[model samples]
Target: MLLVFFLMVAKSVHRIGPTEVGLVTKRFGRKLPDDNPIAFNREAGHQADLLMPGMRMKWWPIFTVTKFPWVQIQAGEIGVVISQVGRSLPIGAKSARYRTEFGTFTDLRGFISGGGEKGVQRPVLPPGSLVPIHPVGFLVITARHVHGLPVAPEFAALARGGKLVAQSFKLDPKQLEVAVIAPHGTTDVIGLVTTLEGEPLPSGDLASRIGAFDDIVALETDRAVTDAQVIDILMGTKNGLHNNYQDFQAFLDAGGRIGLQHDPLLYGAYLLNPFLVRVELVPMLVVNQGQVAVIKSFVGLPTLDTSGEEFKFGSIVAPGHRGIWQEPLRTGKYAINPRIYAAELVPTFILTLNWANAASQAHDLDARLEPIVGKSREGFIFTIDLQVQIHVPDARAPKVISMVGTMKNLVNEVLQSAVGNHFRNTLQALEAVKFIETREQVQQSAHTAVTRYLAGYEIETKGVYIQDVVFPDELVAVLTRREIANQERATYKEQQAAQTARIEMEKARGTADMQAELAAAQVSVDINGNRAQAREAQAGGDAAYTRITGQAEADRVQAIGLAEAKATEALGVARAAGFAAQREAIGEMPTALVAVAGAVAEGKINVVPDILVTGNGSSLDGLAATLMRKLSPAQDGQPG
Candidate 1:
């Protein structure tokens, strides 16, 4: 009896695999009142609760258990949950209702009590997790992860289908620069999105509400997801701070409107759900350093008056208002969506538009303009190449755009036609060849007219230059012949002037030569006069020296004469002294007599003076004779 009972228990046992879940069905239970396929309470049908990976008893022929593999979501993957037996969606409701209080559908009792709508649910299962779903009420489907890399060909195929370039490269602000390398990519690329599944759009609205994560995960899995739906690009306060669709949910929560947005994805990579969003790469709006991007907005608040501001409104708004913006975007990079706002790149730099057949080195904007041609008053046809430089001030860029559309439109629609008409009309009243002679006046007139015309449109004319002029072939031949004759006449006049100059030069040279000879003669006369003056000065100096020497000798002779006379008187006194004293003094007279005789000998006197005779002639004669004899004893030649 024990062995039989163990066999019956073994036969009733059933097992579910580790990677799977089992759904239990109640056997021989009371029938449900509504008789629906699923019973809210345990009835003669599948049970409300699921059996997780384990063995169960009494699950044999009487009660059936269905085994299903747990939903496995890989890294970067998301699983969308769908409830099969929850409350139905209200008739007028847009989608399955979402309420954050229900704890992400993890608690079955809470979900049921919270009246979780029977349909798609919010809050997707994140990457790297397995979810156990009850077969009776819930089903989980694995949503493929979007690959940012190009290993998978889904994006490439979708890109080709939407007529977009499959390849993309990020411009590392430090990488390749546009100023040097120019620009790349198609001119018509755009952000194309096709929402496969989402909340239904409101009445009269082109785009549906921005979906949460669960709605994004519930995108269609097959080919229907690849269809092209133009996506509204993000813009303004939400521009790129949303991190290139990486933080789109936050953008939406921050009052980001749905449908086509005004901000575009710059050149780079993005991971987006294929079913929820599709991108069409569009051309970039490059506002170069010297340009101003005039913005014509199709969305924003009401325009306000700026009648007394630096940026006066001429159908332009202040920075944040609607209508055409007065303050333009200065030089820089901007990711723009063309559908929302039109950006006219008005060059704030010198813009030169050429009216000529030849292309200019400045820019290609004037390549198609034709040379100005008109008939003069004398019915002579002439052609002129004109270059007009214009400028739209940074503050006036939007005004120009409001008046016109773009720089090209301003040139093609307004300036080109106006300038051509003015030249055609004004030149018809001027003389053809004389127009070249007084060309400055024509340029001035052209400039003045154009400036006045452009002032009405808020554009500045910097300058008007007449580049080249082409005359009719026959007119050119006639002009050349007339010019050759005129040049010959000018040459004759110049030759006459040269001859006169040469004659004047010779006259000057002759005068200079005469002055040089006169200077030399004057120098010789000056030398002779200086020599004569030197000789006269020498003679005067010699005569003066002789006169001075003669006076000095006469004065010396006078002094010697006076001294001798005094000595002679003294000798006489001694000789005539009293008898006794005379004898005594006479002895000293001999010494005096010797000194007198010596002086007489030195003087070489031939005769003695009679005045020197004393009282008796004979005695004096005798004394004189004695002195002479004494003096003669010293003579060399005379006999003593």
Candidate 2:
């Protein structure tokens, strides 16, 4: 009893530590206003004035002092203050309206006098703040702990049961710390903000723009504003006014709406009230090389068609309007809120699409495509692997995207039908052999047809190639047999030619073996012919000489014979004349006798017939006698 009396006496001169605040509750004061739980004029209930560090004089039994640890907000942490005592909040307001004089909710008197409401305060205790707030009038909730007295019955019961946590106020423990949008690295990210406490979002809009697109309207009205300039303007943020939702009063003052926010959070730490503002980290819109991002804005000015009447595919608008923008974002990373604006990436480079078994590694647009199968006029089925190269002009990407909705749609729907049907019809019309022979012509025709068809969609056809052809098994077998037969025929012809060549070669070899003997025989024949010719020439010369000599000798002999004949004739004539003279000179008989005697005497006959001419028989004697007489007479006559 004596110690209790000492404690009550010591309480009259209370001492508050440097890190503590003394919350004074007047035990016998006037009743507090019904609308306010705290007393600013020393009424009953909890007193709005806090006892600062050092000392305080509150008479015992008249007032009670309870010491509370000073609201020490740690680094990287914020304290959300809920005011237990103030004027009632206006309907539809989620938090207490804040005033400049409230000054971090440390001055309770100023907060009440400045029309502070009784609820969660608009401005929160920033990081590293050491504030001495009246513990009974306010509760500061942090990530790791909650500080202050529970005012309501349910809250006090929960606190008593150890269930009064940060989640009790619909807040995660980590949310009490500062919200950080980290710097972008390999894949950039952006924070999409969603406000929990603000005016409901306007109808027909998915998100809330702070100024409600008035800036975009002004930009759209300006004739000199370019599409790129409009995108730049839209990227500019109004986070400065609210200091990235750290100052919730400023955000409310600036007409911030609830639900999805148009402006996204860039790279930075923001002390946002978890109960008021929620951030969702999402991937930034990245338009890579060889691509353009066509923006379809859901939050912008009213839609107005910029594409002329000739374009019947879809409506195209300027960048700030609520439709597909004419200009696309070229190869860049954008920190755009995807909920408000949808971006479709359209490739501006040559896009090769294959109608084959394999899908392109660069894109999946042809993943579902397969080789075209068709029957020829001969009922032969054939499979064709084709490749179609198309180009989407950067200037016409928006129109092309609007026409087909996506590149995959262009491949699967439009080009698939155009190319597949054309090839099928073409194959069906042609015989298998004709199609094989005129494959190049078929490719050319397909290219022309595809070019014309894609031109209608404002797309360019770069090339159409027939990559491979898979003929039917029956056709392949027939072709293989025919080719084998042709090869066999060529082999037979070659064998026949080899046999003929072998015959000629054997003949040449036999001739070559007798070459020396043949040469010698030819030389001997030549020698014999030359000798024969020489002999014939010599005989001819001899014959010619003999003929010439014989002719000359014959002529000379004839001349000589003629001359002798003349001479002889003359001599005979002379002799005959002499005989005639002799006969005339003598008488007939006497001339004879004288001639006889002269003949006998000239002949030199021997007169003496000495037994030389003895006649045989009787005639001999008579002839002898005559001869004796003739001899005697001749001798006598010669002498005469």
Which lDDT value does model 2 have at 289? 97
- What TM value does model 1 have? 0.55
The Cα error of candidate 1 at residue 542, in Å, is 39
Highest TM-score scorer: 2
The true-versus-predicted C-alpha distance at residue 482 of model 2, in Å, is 3.0
- The local distance difference test score of each candidate is 0.61, 0.85
Candidate 1: tens digits of C-alpha lDDT, residues 378-430: 88787878899998888777777776766777887888889988888877877
Q: What digit string (tens of lDDT, one per residue) describes model 2 on residues 432-495? A: 9899999999999999999999999999999999999999888999888988999999999999
Model 2 stretches with alpha carbons more than 4 Å out: 1-7, 11-15, 55-61, 157-161, 183-185, 200-203, 220-222, 486-640
RMSD of each: 24.7, 16.2
Candidate 1 whole-model C-alpha lDDT, 0 to 1: 0.61
